[model samples]
Target: MEDLDTLVLRTALRWQATGLPVVLVTVARTWGSSPRPPGSLMAINGRGETVGSVSGGCIEDDLIHRIREGGVQAACATDTPAVLRYGISADEAHRFGLPCGGTVELVLEPVSSRSRLDELLQACLQRRSIERRLDLRTGQVELRDGRRDGVPRLDDTHLATCLGPQARLIVIGAGDLSRFLCQMALGLGFEVVVCDPREEHRASWELDGVVVSREMPDDLILRLRPDARTAVVALTHDPKLDDLALIDALQSDAFYVGAIGSRRNSAQRRERLHMHFDLPEAALQALHGPAGLYIGSKTPAEIALSIMAEVVAVKNGIRRPSPTPVVTGKSLHENPGYEVT
Candidate 1:
């Protein structure tokens, strides 16, 4: 339903009494490469207002144009669910600016109060995860049980998606890089938390929607218990603070624990954690020394972007092209001194 489609979709449905027409777009499939993944949702209002995205921009642009032509007016008759595809050839790919040889398919469904979309939205809001079994034959949806432990799962007939709530990012400093990283992470749907115990760092900090904490990094890491969906980045590089938090994080389930430093410094940090705290080689490897993809990122924002890419790749079961996988500290090779299976 529109509510399951985007947050804006729910707002549209809830505010329908205010009388505004809305259109919804969903990404159904892709081939070769695509900017947005399948299951992504976007919504547009009668006035060309938009929320979320399907393609990088081109598809959204095309959708916007269609809305202007009265594509999704509420007064229009309901449409049977339909599957739409884009970018079948090289020229089309270039026209849409899809990655070379890219193709994407989508499902567009119009919703009303009488539609089952409202039901689906309510079910989703009530549970950590829920499967809306769609009747392709009748378009009726049935709600089923789902899981919230670890990664959530959605095994539905029409689509399979696992949104484990929102990912959390805890940055242990309020420096320029942390600011950039916080913004980048927030855009990617991470609940960004910036922790700075120092007043100097907190005074000048001015990132929006980011949770600022004054607790010590180590204490905060333990409290947050960084889950598999969580990413922990230490930017201060101060062992007195960062090291303890890194130690605590290494023992938890955080998917990514990284420090911004040269590889050499990471090696030194490893030795210290290994000797002082007895952090095994396994845990140390998960400490992404030198963080970020090796994509030649130099600026604070770019570095933040690269690191986010790596974090996302790991989180989404996306295969990393690099030879060495970002170790999760639980891998066998990371444990030369001991064994954890």
Candidate 2:
């Protein structure tokens, strides 16, 4: 499935192309305890149909009611843009189903030729990050190359936001674990690729909606040269397949690089990378050996869940305790007297 943001934008563009009125809503700012952060996007059509979300169901309901009661103009009121705020008071917060003290500010703009959503969507599909600056008064927009991520900026005259590329994943092998992991990643809006040079493995690789490659893992890594928005996971138990990819992935800008193995094998993998590959200690330190957050996962599906959880945690900048990793957790389970140092 497409990422929520992309789905919203694409649906909005489709509606607009079909001569339907559409309003693009963005969460410009938020106060304590908001569900959606700044830069979140949603789109509503003339018929009150919506894609994406700005808040919980209550906020969306309010927007839909406005459209149904007064048409698209109820939200935008004009061809330009409009600013809206919700949940300033306790009663208002409760009515809108917001957490106590939560508030959200939105910019609602009527989708028009000036909105340039088509160009924006094109950039997103191409995996290019673009900053869209919307003039609050004129509804004019400017698009430029942008960083992969940033908070939305709003001023008296302009709103500057980044429309970054979708997050990507490169799986270094194809197996039951890889299939489960790729499925989870796809649902989480990651563009997933599965690479396996082994002909036997490639012959049986039949997952849908994933890019399958027969190139060697290391070669694939070098070709893709994963960016900050990319993640690499080595699932093949074979050191020949997982190690080279791990080596190259650790040297790239990928936000997460991981390998699945037993605790002892994980240590050996690290040692091999450091010695035989002449990789730096710092680079090897970035690897997630026995990849996954510890959850006593024995089945392939459960292991995939743990690994995907760790990948997302790292992506969101959520730092878990050292004891949470699979290796550490298994160690503590096997040896209760063992301490985390």
* The candidate that achieves the highest TM-score relative to the unseen native structure: 2
lDDT of 2: 0.88
**Which lDDT values do the candidates have, in the order given?**
0.68, 0.88
Per residue, candidate 1 scores C-alpha lDDT tens digits across 235-275 of 88677878977999888978788877765566788999999
Q: How big is the RMSD of model 1?
A: 7.6
Query: Which residue pairs show collisions in model 2?
Result: none
Please report the candidate that would top lDDT against the real structure.
Answer: 2
RMSD of each: 7.6, 3.4
In model 1, what lDDT does residue 306 have?
A: 73
Task: Give me the runs in candidate 2 sitting further than 4 Å from their true place.
Answer: 319-321, 324-341
Compute each candidate's TM-score over C-alphas.
0.69, 0.94
- Residue 302 in candidate 2 has what lDDT? 81
> lDDT, candidate 1, residue 195?
86
